[model samples]
Target chain A: MKLLEDRIRRDGRILGTEVLKVDSFLNHQIDPELMAAIGKEFARLFADKKIDKILTVESSGIAPAVFTGLSLHVPVVFARKNKSLTLPDDVWTADVYSFTKEITNHIMIDHRFLVAGESILLIDDFLANGQAIEGLLSITQQAEAEVVGVGIVIEKTFQKGRQLLDGLGVEVESLARITSFDEGKVSFLS
Target chain B: MKLLEDRIRRDGRILGTEVLKVDSFLNHQIDPELMAAIGKEFARLFADKKIDKILTVESSGIAPAVFTGLSLHVPVVFARKNKSLTLPDDVWTADVYSFTKEITNHIMIDHRFLVAGESILLIDDFLANGQAIEGLLSITQQAEAEVVGVGIVIEKTFQKGRQLLDGLGVEVESLARITSFDEGKVSFLS
Candidate 1:
């Protein structure tokens, strides 16, 4: 977590007050070494929960999900942003609003992947509005699966995401939690 | 490569001549151990080539790309499927037609991540019509970057993806090359 926070300070760009652009190393362009370390840290944090699967949304979440899955020796199921033809007829879906794109898209997971009674850990790159994680949670709930915990690489504490998850009574862990971005400088919630 | 071929034979479901769904381990629900093995295989196959970075598309490609990047000890830059607010103004974009979605989507890469004269190894989950790689090639070409080679997890040999890459004079190594999948029985090219 220290390493991740340090990396965020060094490379993360504060886009106004709401967004932290980690495109240099986190999401758009990935640092696999750092990612593996993050994964290890997540695994270390959630090692007690006994996770059967790591669930995430597509695109950005795949990197850390893969890494965490590697460390935990579990399978990672990423919910698709679009309903591709390859996806089977039976799927667990939830509507997720994209604040960036200013649209709502249905995130889906094949029903075969998320079976009943499986324990799932949700992972993602950034948790700001918490819509993405909420969507993932919807799918997990629909599958009649158990929600172990939520693992996040970077979290915006100023936003309602953590509060929202707290209301759901879900255990949440974020490697880097950003408290504020005042004057384009990132401040963390120590 | 042999291991991957064997995995496809064992777990892969043939939907038709074109679609081989390995979502159980490859794409949707990822087996990190198997993916790490794949990453090792790709590293072994492209050991001779000096690759500075591994480039891939988001969603499915991120898992193997991250694994491959870890094994190779390099950065993995994935092209964004949608234009996100986090990405900067300057970007290299390309239009790619998805046979599954039956629509064309623009994939973009942050210009800063890719520099001129950097040798990149393109990695992907599947090589079907080769449009994804072609779109990546366009981005690489625009950046003035040199593509060392292409590493594909599964290549549909019946399709023109390999031939297209061959025509481009690019070295391509497919872990599993499917010659035919007629009647749902996969036949691989030796």
Candidate 2:
């Protein structure tokens, strides 16, 4: 976790006192070694739970989810943003509103992928308003599956995404929790 | 490669002659163990090339790219479909036509990630008409980066995607080459 926090401080770009761009090493341009370490830490934190599948949204979440899948030795099911020609007709769907993009999109997972009674671990790159995680949780609940926990690469604690998810009684393990942002300076909860 | 061909035969769904759906394992629902093996195989195939970074598109390619990056000990950079608020204004962009989706979208990579003269290895989940690869190649060229080679999980030889890329003088290494798909049966060129 120290590695991630240090890297964020050194390489992260703060824009408009709200957005922290760690694209150089975390999302857009990824350091697989560092990504793998974060995944291993997630596996370690959730060592007590039995995870059958790792669920995530498309795009950004795929890397961390894939790495977590690698360490956990479980399959990863990424919920697609749109209905693709390849995806099946029978699917579990949830509507999520992205405050950043100022748009609402449907995220779906094929019914066959999320089997009933399966233990799911949700993973993503960042948590802002918790819309993405809520959408994923909705899909998991529809399948009658149990959510083991969540593993986030970064968290904006000031956004209170933690409280939003915690209210649902979902356990979250974020590698780096951003406590505040003042005058372009970022602070960590850890 | 045998492992990949075997997986295709077992789990890959053939939709008509144009699409081979491996969503259950390769894309939508990912098998990390199998994904890891594919990455290792890609690293083996491109071992001769000196790759400084692994470049791929977002979503599907992230899993294998992550694995390939792990094996090659290089950073992974995924080109995003749309520009978000977080991405910097300075980026290299390309327009791609998705025959499957019947839509044209732009894929872009940060100018800082793909440096000039850096050797890059392009990785992806599937190659049909080589549109995605071509888009990536265009971005790489804009960055003045050298493309070492391309690592494809599956290539539909019948569609002649390989020929398209090969015509451009780009080296392509596909784990499982599909020769034909007739009567709902898939044939591999392994």
Clashing pairs in 2: none
TM-score of each: 0.95, 0.95
The DockQ of each candidate is 0.88, 0.87
Among the numbered candidates, top DockQ falls to 1
Model 1 docking tier (incorrect/acceptable/medium/high): high
Off by over 4 Å in 1: A83-89, B83-89
Predicted candidate 1 versus true structure: per-residue lDDT over B75-131, tens digit per residue:
999998864435446988888899976877789988899999999999999999999
CA displacement after TM-score superposition, residue B172 of candidate 2 (Å) = 1.4
lDDT of 2 by residue, A1-190 (tens): 8999999889999988789999898889999899889889999999889999999999888888888888899999999996343544698988888887788888999988998999999998899999999899999999999998998999999886788878877678999999877877879985
Q: In candidate 2 chain A, where is summed lDDT lowest over 10 consecutive residues?
A: A80-89
Error of 2 at B3 (Å): 0.8
